[model samples]
Every structure is written in C-alpha cells, then in structure tokens.
Target: MTGGSAGAAAGAPWAEFGRRLRSLRRAAGLTQLQLGLRVGYHHSAVSKLEAGLREPPVGLVRRLDAVLETDGELAAILAEPREVPRRTGRFPADP
Candidate 1:
C-alpha cells in the first residue's frame, strides 16, 4: 500500500474512508447492526464497509450520512475518486 511518492501516503483511499466511516458511526453511537438496519444493508455489509474491505453504494453513503448527521462529509468522502499509484517497473532510485 506504499506509494512511491512521499506525498501520496500509504494505504488505499477506500481503507482510509472506511476508517472515517467507522469513526462517524462511533461518534453517533450507532452500532454496525443498527446502522445497517437504518441504511438497508446487512450488519456484515456495514462491517465490511467500515473495515474498508468493500465499496459502499452511493445510496448507502447518502443514507449513512443522513442517519449520522455528518453534514455530508461522509458522502463527500465516499464520492471521492481513489487514485491508484502508477508503476513504471523501475526502482525508486532509478533515473
């Protein structure tokens, strides 16, 4: 998950996104099961999303944002495009 460029940072955006989602849910005092029930997803599905193992649907993101009263931060984060690092098959120090 390391990016060749120092500015890019390691880990997938979705992984970080999932962490944010989990934090939001925790701050709102909602358990994964409860959030899933409110958002029309299974508990496991919510767990996966919060774990950054799965990409949530747009509808789910909207529902989560509304339910958590996050003022659209969650939705905005979910909507962001994730950039994969480009590999040129060269060593980092190669010129």
Candidate 2:
C-alpha cells in the first residue's frame, strides 16, 4: 500500500490514478473546470481523465501533482507495475 500504489488493488492503473486525482482535486477545493484551467485542459478533458476514460499524458500528471500538492503521490501510481491495455484498431474497446 506504500508508494501511493494502493489504488492498484482497486482497479487499473489509469482508474486508480483518476480516483486519486479526484480526491486530491477535491481536497484542494477546486472544481474540475478550475483544475482544467490551471492545467491547460478543458473541463471535459478533466472530466474524462477523472472518469478514467482516457489515459492522461505524463506532463499533465506532473502538473496535477504540483497543483494538488501531492509531492509525487500521483506520479507514483503510474510507476506501479501493471499491464496497460492497448487499442488495436480504429474502433477499439477497453479490456
């Protein structure tokens, strides 16, 4: 449960990352739209990232860590060992 990978047991890395992001954003008293503005993304993009419907880019994740004052907790979730699902075609589905 250390290293901030505790969410791994709950679900996929991206999902876990989203969960953490949502929690941190709330703790910082920011709405998704506000967070998106601070991170240079649209509110819908923040919504997608929080819903785990999209994998966030590394730079964004780092920005989130800084914005949320996590001191690297968010980044540690990405460092956890896990099999990330890959899209195979034009129309792809998550595993």
Candidate 3:
C-alpha cells in the first residue's frame, strides 16, 4: 500500500524519519524530484518516504543521508527499535 497505517503516522519512527528527511531536503533547497534523482530513486518514492508511507531500505537511507548532508541523523532514526510484525502460521515463511 502507498499509505502509512494510522498508527505508523502517529509518531512512529518511520514517520519521524520522514519528517527529518523533509526538513533536511528543504534546508538543502532541493525539491523532491531533485532529491530523488540525486539518490537514484523516483520522485514518487521520495514522496512516499516523506509521507511516511514506506520504510526506506537501508541502502537508500544511506544514500539519502549522504545526499541531504544529514551527518547520519537520518540513519539514527531508523536505527531505533520498532515492532516487527510476527508472521502468522497461515503465511509462508519468508525466504
């Protein structure tokens, strides 16, 4: 889905990460499209991240941090512990 859950939007770590990303992007005077291009992602992907609709992959987070010159602030947000969804028995095990 392209939207964050209500709980996630309500002060989740990813949401905080998104907020920081937006702030840094603005401080750097870069548009979403520009940031995406610099980080090798589509602008929609950047929008989704800024909206807290997705958790960025680790590699992408590093790229974002570097591109935005956050000095590891962005990475630190993701490093904080969050709850993992436990798989149900009905679902196949992840590879």
lDDT of 2 at 54: 79
Residue-level lDDT of model 3, residues 1-95, one tens digit each, is 33446456756547888888989999999999999999999999998788777889999999998988888888899988888778776967699
Number of backbone collisions per candidate: 0, 0, 0
- Judging by lDDT, tell me the better candidate of 1 and 3: 3
Q: Which candidate ranks first by lDDT, i.e. highest?
A: 3
In order, the Cα lDDT scores of the candidates are 0.78, 0.82, 0.85
Q: Whole-model lDDT for model 2 versus the true structure?
A: 0.82
Error of 1 at 65 (Å): 0.4
lDDT of 1 by residue, 48-79 (tens): 77666777788888888899998898878866
Total colliding residue pairs, candidate 1? 0
How well does candidate 3 match the true structure in TM-score terms?
0.75
Against the correct fold, how does model 1 do in TM-score? 0.74
Report how far off residue 42 is in candidate 2 (Å): 0.4
lDDT of 2 at 95: 85
Residue 46 in candidate 2 has what lDDT? 86
The C-alpha RMSD in Å for every predicted model, in order, reads 6.0, 9.0, 6.8
Candidate 2 structure quality by residue, lDDT tens digits, 1-95: 24444443346447878888889999999999999999999989987777666788999999999988999998899888888677776865588
- Pairs of residues at least 3 apart in sequence or in different chains that clash in candidate 2: none
Off by over 4 Å in 1: 1-10, 87-95
